[model samples]
Target: MAERVNRLNDLTPREWIRFQKSWFIHNPPPREPGVLVHPGKFPEGLAREFIEFFTKRGQSVLDPMAGTGSALVAAVRSGRQALGIELNPDFARLAEQRVQAERLALGDQAPQARVHVADARQLDQLELPPVDYCLTSPPYWDMLRQPGFETQRQRREDGLPTTYSDDPRDLANIADYARFLDELVAIYVKLHACLRPGAYLTVVVKNVKKGKRMYPLAWDLGRRLGETYLLKDERLWLQDNVRLAPYGMFNAWVSNTHHHYCLNFRRE
Candidate 1:
């Protein structure tokens, strides 16, 4: 039998217990004006929690789908080296600017944060070091393109793009759910090559809703990726701050889904 080593070098027993809880509340800070252009940005505070738990100081963390550098910033703030690859040139530059600001603020002690402009599908082509941990949030399928979403409507009115990028390479732009999942899973499979042995990969995602049908995106990813890596468990991220609207009122039963699955996997 192979020996099982403890991976929780940086976390205390109490902290481990806290993270083990099935669900927790995380209301992200108001999106900074600069990053508001990326409609699906995750919270830096949330990213920090995962980074700190999974890695020790000076270890490297990677975000393959870094949108405006939330994961990179969080990794640096948590005293870990950071790398992010963004597909959109505009978003990649914005992420670089944000990382630069973070480094400047940290002065001499700032950990390295590098944001690369590249397609996540071509992760192997990039010169990346073996990462200790990965924390990222992929786009929730093609939900950004749906016209009925209030957030999408607001972004469209503000002259921002409703989708991630106009480029066809952007996974969010894929209209077909199955094709999107295949491409996304392929990206993760490539990402698995970059992780050190026993390292953790945390993906923050939510099941998507299009028209009247609900797609089990998070569940599907968990099932597919589980074949490649050990499915450790999942933590639910509940959002209490967002204003809830009646998604399907009167005729059908549609509850507001205010939670996201923080799927954790380990490379064995």
Candidate 2:
């Protein structure tokens, strides 16, 4: 099949609505008021799209950083077997509970889904099946932390944290951009072992702006993982529902009309 060429602000109205339905906007329901570094969870609609695009019914899908079970729930909804590993014990338990609750709510409609509390850096210890498709979004450093005094002041009493991974050893914890890229790429290399031959791996990531520095996370991931897997293509997740940017031409030349890159790779 010919790859789809997507650019920011080029999606059709139908495509835009499909993106909205597949994933919820960044706004989430209320939670305990604490700094949630990685509190932002993915919507099931987008997850289902990746799951359906890469796997068949009853195929196994794995998520190494299964935050809150978004990908797992989506896989189940698509009638695919799902497995996940999370480092945080709290998040892992939450993911497990959410998967079970989803199954109960879905009744016979749900596929087999399971989640384990494990670190992405040490997938070798975890006994996971050969995954047909591995789809996930890793932490985007500490960008989740409150940015400036003005932004912090605007934050609500109960809001998501600036960084999700509390692990001191997490790749997001590394301050050096190069080191962060190396370690993050290493995690994906480890994941390469868990994928079946000729299977697909889609990573949902984006470059991050922190302290006036740009960390090209998505680009680096594509470059590094491309060494092990074929750099297939990318699809942009454009969001038209986001608040308009105020600094496009003022003090800062920021363009924030909503978009994320879905880098696709295939294990050779």
Candidate 3:
């Protein structure tokens, strides 16, 4: 029997994107408490896939918006050094604990991973080492605010107001989406100084719909950041685990598919 060599010509552009999505199609099993504490965190499997595809072992990887340190965990698991910066104090502490626990289990050879409680927008002030790759997911604008009150998670946790969706405070607080976008772009721009040339930056973001208005957040991010770095390709992260839409009950048309646009760029 002969070995098979798959050629790029075997698939069309759309097919190639679909193929990549296929590899990550399965839903991540619910995490056990003490293992991971956040729902917004990216799946470790996806983070590992990005780290493996973008860099070699021993290389350094960074995740600025490292919610629960998912990317950091992935980097360490892949034998790459990892650094994460988080804005939320609770999430940062949780990430630090998780990494420390993992280190205790995996020993020193596992990539050194650390998470610091700091604003992603202020990386210039943080003493972070150079990075070979950066993978992160930004907070989806206040969709949790859809209801008048806080999110269940926010409510369950004392003093933590509902945020990142449908919340008035979360959405209303950002009076300038343009400013928010610019600030995010500037953060990555600052991060570019730390990346090795040719290193890849992957951002997972999605468009937002509110009040019948669409914010091309993902697209605009690409465009604005494109000036600082080379705007490369994108990967669509399709979630298959969401409940079916209930458009029939309201006689409305709603999309059941939740997709994240994984934008890949390179430091120039």
TM-scores of all candidate predictions against the true structure: 0.95, 0.81, 0.81
Top TM-score hit: 1
- lDDT head-to-head 1 vs 2, winner: 1
Error of 3 at 234 (Å): 0.7
CA lDDT, every model vs. true structure: 0.91, 0.74, 0.73
lDDT of model 2 at position 135: 92
Residue 175's C-alpha lDDT in candidate 3?
53
**Superior candidate under lDDT, 2 versus 3:** 2
Pick the winner on TM-score between candidates 1 and 3.
1
Candidate 2 displacement at residue 260 in angstroms: 0.4
Candidate 2 lDDT, 1-268, residue by residue in tens: 9976542224455855665443434432343332143356667777886787677777889999897788998888777888998877777887787778778887877878889887788887887788899999987765555354233334444463445556887666677778778777888898888888888898988887766566788888888889989998888776665557465475767656366778889988
Top-lDDT candidate index: 1
> Which ten-residue region of model 2 has the weakest summed lDDT?
28-37
Question: lDDT per residue, candidate 3, 19-115, as tens digits?
Answer: 4652245476776565434546678888887787778778888998887888888888778888998776777887887777777778857668888
lDDT at residue 112 of model 1 (Cα atoms) = 94
